[model samples]
Target: MTERQQHKRRRGAGVAAGVLCVCLAGSGCAQSGAAAEDAREGEAVQAVRSAADALVGARSSKARTSMEMATGGTRVTIRGEGVYDFRRQIGQLKVQLPQDPAGTPDQRPIMELLAPGALFMKNRGAGVPADKWVRVETRSLSDGNLVTGGATDPFAAAEVLRGARTATYVGEDEIAGTPVRHYRGTADLGIAAQDASDGNKESLAAAAKGFATDKVPFDVYLDEAGRIRKVRHRFSFVNGQMNNAVAVASTTLLYDFGAPVDVRLPDGDDIYAGKIAEE
Candidate 1:
């Protein structure tokens, strides 16, 4: 940690900045400032909805995500992917993996379990029942994707803003240096008493009472035709810890498929160790 960073405790300007950083890069089906893009909003929502529904039915996904997590001033980088075995009826949403697979280093696991319940986590082991995993997947009011953890899940968050007294569209901004439009709102999503990546799973269950199903602030950006371009959430008492995901400094649309994002299945022989996704 940098000298300036080490001094920051759980609550500080540093914390606010980190939370703002996350909101900006967050997700939604919104497309802003363009006639052509606005015309496509309806199509975009349908596409996302269909894809999400298909995923629940078929059980698999293939894609790459570059993730950066910053707490106070500490930031970590990781590559993420989602893989599932239909035959086994199981899915693994990997939030982090090494860019260099050759080293085959013994690394920690980032698996979110969304089947049968809600949870969030990283660095967990294998063979635990899927329901026990730490991850939550639900229909996003923004752009539906089996969102893993954090404020990614849509409905879980939207409900928090239900009948929110104060709401408004701010200007535009950036996250992690990426550009985006901004929206702002307020509500009361409770607190968390534990670390999402660590700590007891039961505590998480109680903590989620606020996180997974409570009230909080939200900022949603729509592209041209009110298509959710990006979404941000701010909640407190989460895990009884500091809260973020509230203010949207930026709204970025990560993926857009005129159609479905089909997941390519792996061949039996090709599914060996060290064999990640291949084009």
Candidate 2:
């Protein structure tokens, strides 16, 4: 070969080597990315497990809960702050009630205390005695009722965590100005607490509409201590009983672990003495 031809051949060989090296580097990067993703997934699972364990071991906590529901042109929202006792499955939450648009300006917001077998409601409105607590016996309420059942049970947290099937670290977030790690996963609906009241389960099922029943998605945030800071769930329902299945979404935040919760059953005088009191 001529000298010029030989030089061109060597330049072509050098270009091929450079291309090969580039391809190899790209492959290494791809592998590293996959490994990092796997590590993040594993970390998510461990974080969730740790939070679940902490919830199971905790005695009590201060909790805030909010749920928004939309069905058939109607929208409803319930928000509350309370003290929850995990061991007893009972709590005293001050639930906030919607204001009456046409009601008097002097009307005060409603608050309720939910305990096992009984509920103490305040500000139930006119015709009901003022400054008195209306205690409703839970046994008379149907299984589909909210507070009448175990809606406030702390064990529900365990149920949520345990039901997670495949979890992945989504990213980091902050709740109430505190930094937290967020993990998202698909939940096993069959493992949801069957012993809980239908109202509670219904809320969960309602959020799963249009999604696979076996794999309802849920998100949980944990603090540095591996304690759950917040949990969010969305699902939809298709029930024959309603005009159409409703879409439901719920969020729960937990803090002040092991905090003292002063929960008391209603006093005899505080209970409405009437034969039939509206709850």
Highest TM-score: give the candidate number.
2
TM-score of every prediction relative to native: 0.37, 0.63
Of candidate 1, the 10-residue stretch with the lowest lDDT total is 192-201
Model 1, span 59-163: residue lDDT tens: 333333443445455454455545432222333445654433356674665654332233344344444332333233232211122122422332222223332
Lowest lDDT sum, 10 consecutive residues, model 2, at: 143-152
lDDT tens digits by residue: candidate 2, 1-279: 699999999999999999999999999999999999888777776677567567647777888877676644667576778787765656776666544345635346456675544557777654567777777654344321222221333445445565566798888899998899888887665544332334235433332332324455678888887777898766544444563545556667898889887777667887766654444
Judge candidate 2 against the unseen true structure and give its global Cα lDDT, from 0 to 1. Answer: 0.63
> What is the lDDT, from 0 to 100, of the residue 110 in candidate 2?
55
